[model samples]
Target: MKDLLIGVDIGGTTIKHGIITKEGTLIDKWEIDTDITNHGENVPYDIWNSIKTRLTDLQIGYDRLIGIGVGAPGFIDPISGVVAIAVNIGWHDFNLKEILENLSNLPVYIDNDANIAALGENWKGSGQLVSNMLAVTLGTGVGGGIIANGQILTGTNGTGAEIGHMTVIPENGYHCNCGRTGCLETIASATGFVRVAKQWIEEGKADSLKVRLQEQGNLSTKDIFEIARSGDESTNQLIEYILDHLGLALANLAVTLNPAKIVIGGGVSKAGEQLSKPLQKSFDKYALPRAKEACEIVIADLGNDAGIFGGAFLALQKS
Candidate 1:
């Protein structure tokens, strides 16, 4: 009979959900395959059905639920709960909050997936103790979130923290999905990491990665980092190049927002100190002296759950 919250994180492949207490305790979690067919028309229905089933199984009445919070990809108008577009999910000008609220008769709050992850980290993960922090996710692409004075900055058009699109190499830079070249995403994301490694190898920069790439016919950021860890000079240099761009982008963000902690997450972050050590060195070099002295960079602690936790926090705030 305790008040509970539902957190939903919508991704390209799956939808992750969690039942959490008002106090930020995650009680249960589950996931459902994302049904992006038919322009994602069934997404809201699927989420509602899943939540009802879970609540029934737990003997929790609908009246005990305070609200629902959703973290979705793409541009979102948090004030209106309308998703302008989510290419991955095929949503265009979708009123996600209204759809879910009409279906479940519950108040709903929504925001960008990365922003919610930042909120989750600030509330219960690595940034728990910091009131202001920046959360960066380095996966197939780069995503970022900014928290200032304990609130997510959703800027005009909800694109404020789209840090991936920040141009790092204005000249002769790789093309980004945003239809631009030289974005930080082009050089620092997992895809970018592999692209650079492949390009370097193709240019005849012989290294241990060349053999691995020849054997596997492809390489992941993990594979590159593993080779670098083995002291492959060429691979190490590639990592340094990647971190240099990433560090510069982060440092620029630091000077602008002056966050107390920078929490990094996502698949690429699994490289650990192999990534963080050099990343910090580069950050220190580019960041303002005062900002450099005040901030610390750390890895995300909650992993995939950060989004769900963040969703719950949003629901709690609205309730």
Candidate 2:
């Protein structure tokens, strides 16, 4: 029997799992609600149970599975498989690997969710062609992962590529969830996009978006991009504002890390070229010429599947 790999991506609201072959083919995928209640104490058991049930349904014995890899949102101690903190999921210094292994009786590997996503992209997605790459996720917040010389550069504490928390605006910047001011996430994430648009409306900038905001009570990053695509000058300016900061952040990463490709993912990337075109312009303006020439900004292809694929890759490596 061919050995199978199990990949698990644990999010705030849901847990995604995949059954993959050693050669990187996804055989099956499914999801389950994350029971974050009680400090997420049941999450590990839930995952173990789900995997066991799936294996039973497939009539595959436990020995046929090579290992399990988990991508979780938090500051994880990759070597120890312990999550130091995960505010969204209410995990604190949790020994995730030990618990999951106890239940599945298989070797388990775990890492930060963003890091795993980067690995997934590096292994099979947009960054696959490059030896050095970065994956930046722009969602409610910004998350980043770095691949250096074909390896995940997880820092000593597994928090190395935390690009979102990098301070971009030291003066009069909005507060970040990390209890800091002026993080890149403050101005470049989907929430930041909406915050800027609302600020413009409050400052008496009248445009088509004002009517939409008044009607909808809120605007998504998508809504802003759609307005910009239709030649709305004010919305276009808003997009430029967002891209300016995003570009600056990415350029800094480019000059520092000299990654061959920077793959953009998450909800905000759905803006597509509306985000990339202006973003590339800003990046080129700020990046060192040599670094800028070496790196290309591209969108992620795997979407949500990146994490699962990355998890499976990790399992395959460790097994």
Candidate 3:
């Protein structure tokens, strides 16, 4: 009986894998470093090989597998399973489903990374059972997935709910990975925040945070948050700037969608209250009274595993 499912979450640095049941229970999970070498030409094979090794070790027969689901960064054509562009993963017009299907000989499905995270959160995380919700991921880059009327909103080209690409700065903004300028991702993402911090320090804002950042070469979001909590004026100010933009963008989306819950996920969200409180305040500042009152902001319960669960959810839909 084909009762098992495979969930794969592809990121720039890592690829998370999971074994799931059709009922959405996570059976087991693991991860591997993403090999972005040669435009990630070996990624598909690597994934299949790892799955094969795991299955062999677990003594799970191939017949027990139902299908595979994938969550990848960047633009995707879910219907055709073509990755239009995942710059971080070095894939362009890549036939992800085809390659995986050819390798694993199982059915495959794919969606934007953020969309799956939203689905996962809706299914088993903080946003569970919510009919209307928004899921945002703050990582190396910001990504969003919108749920309206209990359905993931994939625009005509399957690019709906792309909150990160929204233009926050019309001019003189940092360049975005999406070939745009002043995107919310450039301000709200960890990369963006660090970039701005470094720029500020280099531009003559002498501070303890600057010294720490310089000493560490690249600082994690947790490090930055810790410093902010310690009352590092520069770090706190940068956090404020980022939350302001994030809040404003989420506020606009909130009014338009009237979602009941806005779920925060991804690595950066690990800062917990330190990040959420000010973000909520910023959100309240920009959101309509009714919308703000109606919505509840919550941290994602799944942490990094949200994507894996989301992939499972996608596969279960087909199963």
Candidate 4:
């Protein structure tokens, strides 16, 4: 019988799972809404039940299944598969591995979502040629994963490559949800872009964004990017700020890690060259010439499926 690996990605709102062969071909995929508010403490159990129910629904025998891999949002212990902390999910010191193993009777592996996404990209996405690369996800908050020499590089304490939290300003800047000030996420994330745009409107700037906001009642990140594409001055300025911050952050990573390519994938990255063009230029400005020359900042090839595909691949690799 062929070994089958199960991969699960636990996000703030959803849990995505995929079953795959050892060679990385996806065989099945499914997702469930994550009840972070009520069941935050039992993330592992929820994750296990999700997979068990999905596999059972598919009529796959437990004996034919191999190990499981999970990608979660938080500080994760790669060695022990414990979720140390996740601000959004309200989980701390979670022994995810023990709980999942008990629930499913399968060997399980878990890591931060960004790291597994990077592994997935390296295995099947845009970073195929590059041995060293970084994966940055621009969702509600910016998340990053660093892979070096074909291995996921989680530093001591399993908190390495938190690119979003890197400081872009020193004092008197917008505060981050992580209780910090001047984090890059404050300037570059989806929330940060809207925050800056709202301030512009408050400053009496004229733009289509105000009209859109008034009509739509709320501004999503996609709305802002779309408005910016129309050459709205206020929104354009905000995009410039986001690009600068993102570029500076990428430059710092380039100098430090010397990765051959930086792969960007997220809801924000879908903006395409509307984002990458300015971002590439900004990276050139902030990064050292040699580092800039050595690295290529490119958009992430994978879409929403990256998490599921990467999660599945991580499980297969571990097994």
Summing lDDT over every window of 10 consecutive residues in candidate 1, give the lowest-scoring window. 201-210
Clashes of each: 0, 0, 0, 1
> What's model 2's TM-score?
0.97
Write the residue-wise lDDT of candidate 4 on 227-262 in tens digits.
888888777777887799889889988999999999
Give the candidates in order of lDDT, highest first.
1, 2, 3, 4
Best-to-worst TM-score order:
1, 2, 4, 3
lDDT of 1 by residue, 31-117 (tens): 999999999989999999999999899888898888999999999999999999999999999999999999999999999999999
State, as a TM-score between 0 and 1, how close model 4 is to the true structure. Answer: 0.93
Candidate 4 residue-pair clash tally? 1
Across 1-319, the per-residue lDDT of candidate 3 in tens digits comes to 9888898999899999999888878778999999999999899999999999999988999999989989998899889999999888899999999999999889999999899889889988999768899999998888899888877888888799888899988999999977889999998898887787777778876376677877887766677788888988877888888899899999999999999999998788889998899999999999999999999999999988888988988888776
Q: For model 3, what is the C-alpha lDDT against the true structure?
A: 0.89
The TM-scores, one per candidate, come to 0.98, 0.97, 0.92, 0.93
C-alpha lDDT (0 to 100) for residue 247 of candidate 3: 95
Better of 2 and 3 by TM-score: 2
What value of lDDT does candidate 2 attain over all alpha carbons? 0.91
TM-score for candidate 1, please give it: 0.98
Candidate with top TM-score is 1
